[model samples]
Target: MASRSTLLKLTFVVAMVLAVVVLPPPADAAISCSQVLGYLRPCIGYVTGSVPGKVPPAVCCTGIKSLNSAAKVTPDRQAVCRCLKQLANGFGSGPVNRAGAVPGKCGVNIPFKISLSTDCSKVR
Candidate 1:
């Protein structure tokens, strides 16, 4: 008993709703280790203990939190782990060890250990 115009409007509304429901969500941008490193670089002095008695700054903890969130995917996590390992190797053992402790110090619980010799391939 509906008029043609009303039926057409109803059909259009239903179609629009269905399309919205059926369409796949937009994909998230891929995270890269370089991006993660960029965030962490500001915290280097604190992490490496280069500045004696210096605790990590607020920016450092913010960067740590961002990296932790970004590396949620397995691939991103592994990439970050490898990058961290390479970065650790560039410093000597003492600094590298200190660097590994940054995440915990910042209260970020990354899944894998951060070490110069960490096997990134084993990170999950």
Candidate 2:
């Protein structure tokens, strides 16, 4: 049987694909890609396995919680969704599963999955 961490990792990978399918947003995006990336960068080490642990670091959780709080409305949420989708596109499966596990590990509940077929249009 798979370890708990492995199971969680697989679940997140599927969610990441939900984000993967986010279409390009309008020119007047509520959130910028830069902003989304900034909030997420701190978690990269944990998600990518550079950090040696199953739990995400405090800084990583803080960023995820902050991002969760920051995107208050549908437009902002969708903007974030799109940005996340863009992020997943550049990474391979290993990182995606790792990244997927971060939000849950940090105690944040994402409103939607982040997989390629997630249909960001329905994120709200």
Candidate 3:
């Protein structure tokens, strides 16, 4: 039977410990669509800069597929590709979007105008 104040203090301390010890997403965890979108945000500038040019490097595509299989093979793959294509075309760089275009790590090849761009900076 702890007092209310004591129980509250204990709760707070436990919460603080959990906050410090609890981990974020694993390095190899599957990323949600929203997370993927966030990761690709900054790369927009980098990609748009190269509009009307060759697509982004294969490394970019490889990295994306490696990070999230959903980005490449899942039924949502097309949505991801389409979203990226729109972003590339809108940004005026057909190439950067192409950089993200490629088969997913699971071997699902996305066939569209160009592949999506992948920026891993958001992944911790």
Candidate 4:
């Protein structure tokens, strides 16, 4: 009985040690890739849209390059594209609007604006 009790205690100690070694760090312990991505999302919209004026928001540019490094097609890229299209559409183009005007016909269809432009400059 004494030997069995000693063995059980030893096994419990080993299990605790293994648990401590194997467990992941706590959520607050460090910054993770997902957290970085989350921070970048809003910046994407601002940069792509040329917010507050013609000059792009500096924060937006910083996050986008970091996001691009991680993935070929990032969530940030999509957000920025959508924002630019929406901004362009706000300008409202005309029928046969050849002079770098956004297609007013799209109205709320931000996706359609991108299809019309080779680059955003053409739409703006």
Q: Estimate each model's TM-score.
A: 0.70, 0.73, 0.35, 0.28
The candidate maximizing lDDT is 2
Q: Between candidates 2 and 3, which one is better according to TM-score?
A: 2
Write candidate 4's Cα lDDT for 1-124 as tens digits.
5698899999999999999999986633333445454645554343344444433345544554454343333343344444444444554443213212222221212222343363533331
Q: Which stretches of candidate 2 lie over 4 Å from their true place?
A: 1-29
lDDT on C-alpha atoms for all candidate structures: 0.81, 0.83, 0.50, 0.44
Q: Which window of 10 residues has the lowest lDDT sum in candidate 1?
A: 46-55
Compute the lDDT of residue 90 as modeled in candidate 1: 77
lDDT of 4: 0.44
Q: What C-alpha lDDT, on a 0 to 100 scale, does residue 23 get in candidate 1?
A: 96
Q: Which lDDT value does model 2 have at 85?
A: 80
lDDT-superior candidate, 2 or 3: 2
Highest TM-score against the true fold, candidate:
2
List model 3 lDDT by residue over 37-110, tens digit each. Answer: 66455344435554333444444454455545545444445455445555555444444533443333224454
Say what the RMSD of model 3 is: 9.9
lDDT of 2 by residue, 1-124 (tens): 9999999999999888877777554554487779988998898888778888979999999999999998878888888888888888888878777787788888899887766556778887
User: Which stretches of candidate 1 lie above 4 Å from their native place?
Assistant: 1-30
Task: List the candidate numbers ranked by lDDT, top first.
Answer: 2, 1, 3, 4
